[model samples]
Target: MEKALVYINYPELIPLNDKSTEYDGYITIDDKFTYRIKLQVPNFPDVKNITYSGGRFHYIAIQEEDKLFKLAYYDIPKISSELLKEYASLNELFTTYCNCIEELQTYFDVMDSIDTVCWVIDPPKPKKSDYMRRIMIGHNVSIQITFDPLNILNLPQIQFMGSENGVAPFRESFINNLDNWDPEYDVVQNILRLIDLPFFPQEPTDAAKSNDLDFKVNECCICFCVQLENKLPDEICKNPNCEQCFHTDCLYQWLSAVGTSRQNFNLIQGECPNCKTCISCRIPNI
Candidate 1:
């Protein structure tokens, strides 16, 4: 029955063996790209029995593949355990898979373009799912930009990281020139125009100086480590006099244990560990 359905609906897919449980084919998207895929259906017409036997889709390796898979599983429709599913369900699965591939392609293309114009400080080698990047914009200054993978041409969310005095002018320039951003320009060009900078600062060539800068920029106050769980310290104390930095997870854990800390919706209000000034740490939804 499955063999018949494949022949009727997907003539391009060819059976791998006599059992007809496995098939391999090239799935074309928008008449522009063809992806070689292998699908396995152990039980005919059972949506739960299908699996992706291919190693990596388009050689794109995302750090959040497990999260993406869970989302897809819950979002995709499922049939009752006792009933056989229609071919439409299988079609939906293929459609969702193709959409993911297309999104990843766009994400990598943008990342490659950004790499040429800026030195990415965090996540030195970005994965397909790592949409947020920290790049050097000036001496002792950096900016974190988060891109929407699906909307590659849109203006990204930006946050400046460094001394308040050092980033103030850049922040003001960015706000004043927000309307000047053009989708026709690439990501690097738009950022340059927004900050009114001719070019991003080049990375330091002196090994000793670069190491010293990295230590000061990435160390967490609580953990006293440069990296924890493949992430640098991103949370900062808001108090101008006590601008201590910490990992978000580390701060959350510390705040949860503190007697004076209070939870307010998604934010944990507490005193800074260094200077004891009032501060808040945003709880990550993930």
Candidate 2:
């Protein structure tokens, strides 16, 4: 089948089971969740030969220097027949898992001081020895289920691990689901109520609200003249109290009228752009 083109330039894309450098499709999921996870499979060595498996815990290590996360392994857990029916992959299951955790955290405000984002998955195999494909979640909480390692080893290599990306779609859907979930009024209301953030859900705003959103540096105080032909354009204004620097010639002409514009600075106690509080400044006359 013809594969799609990807424009990502991530240098550490390998060793994460990114399949042959030229390959651009789903990779295998070691026999765990019955192949529910299908995404960019990084190259993992020596995982398929063993069985004694159920659900595996997956790990993704943080690479601070490269700003990329390395593919850690997933610890697949033994899924009951009931769960397999509903979830295609563990990542899909996590959406509900995370949502429930978040809801519980926000509503109760007592997450046992443990970072709540932690849950079970396969752990990285390269860095650790005596690797177990047990389903363990959370860094702080070593919650895990035992597996039959000897039984897993008897499984055929091709059969033990799926060659295709079984869980990729579930990962894609779980991570990017928010792209389609727009924050409509009702969604916002439910989220606010469920998560209990301090956000005041306001209605459609008017033009007056725009003033708060302006990004211009309104409070600048320096004015200087520059040779635009030789460098950049020089501009000046008489509001010496303003932080905006002006061109020398422009400043001289504006102040030349009353001499009140000498190196002298004039300030008016005026209200600020947002809170209407009086702000004063001595504009630098350069």
Using lDDT, give the best candidate's number.
1
Model 2, residue 136: distance off in Å is 36
Error of 2 at 131 (Å): 29
Please give each candidate's TM-score: 0.63, 0.16
Q: Please give, for residues 221-269, the per-residue lDDT of candidate 2 as tens digits.
A: 2233223222221221223243243333333444444323333345323
lDDT of the candidates, in the order given:
0.66, 0.27
RMSD of each: 7.4, 24.0
The TM-score of candidate 2 is: 0.16
Q: Which numbered prediction scores highest in TM-score against the true structure? A: 1
Across residues 6-125, which tens digit of lDDT does each residue of candidate 1 receive? 566468988889988777777665565566756565653332223232233332111112112112232111223211221243444455455555445655667777876777878777
What C-alpha lDDT, on a 0 to 100 scale, does residue 165 get in candidate 2? 34
- How many clashes does each candidate structure show, in the order listed? 0, 65
